[model samples]
Target: MKHYLLAVQIDETVPEPEDELREQLARTAKVSDEIKAAGAWVFAGGLLPSHASTVVRPGNGTTTMTDGPFAETKEQLGGFWVIQCEDLDEALAWADRCALACARPIEVRPFDDVV
Candidate 1:
């Protein structure tokens, strides 16, 4: 089995209403349960707003810490699921369900294996 990251992207400019957010969370939980039952769920979690993020960069001989994400974009990574699947096709199928449950775009990326 290969590990893949199913990332949920959110448009931070728009805010989800309280009721909608609750519903989305419930749906997401249901999906998570389904994944776990299938034995593919490694781990998953949601994230705080991008404004709360800090970036650490390495310089010549020291490191610089800055507020915010590495890039300035309307969309940011809101959550992610690390899952083990047979191949990209399986990962993409899982991403589709996750996108529906969270009402956001899901990006599927395979993790690099140690040589």
Candidate 2:
């Protein structure tokens, strides 16, 4: 099996109400449980807002750190799930469910096999 990353894309500009967010989290948790039951779950988690992120960049001989995401976009990676799948098709299937549960876009990408 190959590993895939299902990235949740969220638009930060639009604020989610507390009640709605609670419902969405409940749905997402259900999907995560399903993935675990299917033996496909490797790991999954939600992330703090982009403002809580720190970006580190390499310079000439040192590194510089910034206090936000690498990109300045309203849509950012909100969370992710790493799962083992038979192929791209299977991974996409999971992404479908994940997107529905979270009511957000899901970006599915496979991990490089070569170490």
Candidate 3:
């Protein structure tokens, strides 16, 4: 089985309704349970807003630090899931569930296989 990364993209500034958020959380829990039951789940989680990021770069043996994420964009990676699947199609199915649960976009990518 190959490992795929399922990334969830969300608008950091948008505040969802309390009821809607609750619904989303419930849906996500259900999806997580499904993934686990399928033995595809490796890891999954949500993340803090991009504003909480810190960037560090090294130049000429010196390290420079910056506040906030590397890029300022309308859509940021809000969370992700690492899952082992048979193929891209299976991964896409999982991504679809994630998108529906979170009401956001999900990007699915496979990790390179090296033995």
Candidate 4:
């Protein structure tokens, strides 16, 4: 099985109302439960806003740490799910469900094999 990452993208510029946010979370949780039941779930988690992130960069001889996300974009990675699937099609099916549940875009990518 190949491991794929379903990354949830959130547009920070648009604010989600409390009620809508709650409903989205509920729907997302249901999808997560389904993934787990299918024995495809490896891990899943939601993240704080991009502002809460920290970036570390390597320099000539040292690493520099910076507050906030590495990229400056309205659309940021809000959460993700790592799951094992038979192929890209299976992963895409899950991504479709996830995107609808969260009312956001889902970026599906497979993990590279270890050498």
Stretch of 10 with least lDDT, candidate 4:
69-78
Q: Write model 2 residue lDDT over 22-84, tens digit each, in one string.
A: 999999999999999999999998999999999999999999998998998879999999999
**Local distance difference test, each candidate:** 0.96, 0.96, 0.92, 0.96
lDDT head-to-head 1 vs 2, winner: 2
Clashing pairs in 2: none
Once fitted onto the true fold, the runs of candidate 1 whose alpha carbons sit more than 4 angstroms away are: none
Error of 3 at 35 (Å): 0.3
Tell me each candidate's RMSD, in Å, in order: 0.9, 0.7, 1.4, 0.8
- In angstroms, the error of model 1 at 112 is 0.4
Return the TM-score for candidate 1, rounded to 2 decimals.
0.97
Shift of residue 114 alpha carbon in model 3, Å = 4.4
Candidate 4 whole-model C-alpha lDDT, 0 to 1? 0.96
Q: Which stretches of candidate 2 lie over 4 Å from their true place?
A: none
Per-residue alpha-carbon lDDT of candidate 3 for residues 1-115, written as tens digits (9 for 90 to 100): 9999999888877887999989988998899999999999999988888988889989999999999988889899889999999999999999999889878899999998975
Candidate 4 ranges with C-alpha deviation above 4 Å: none
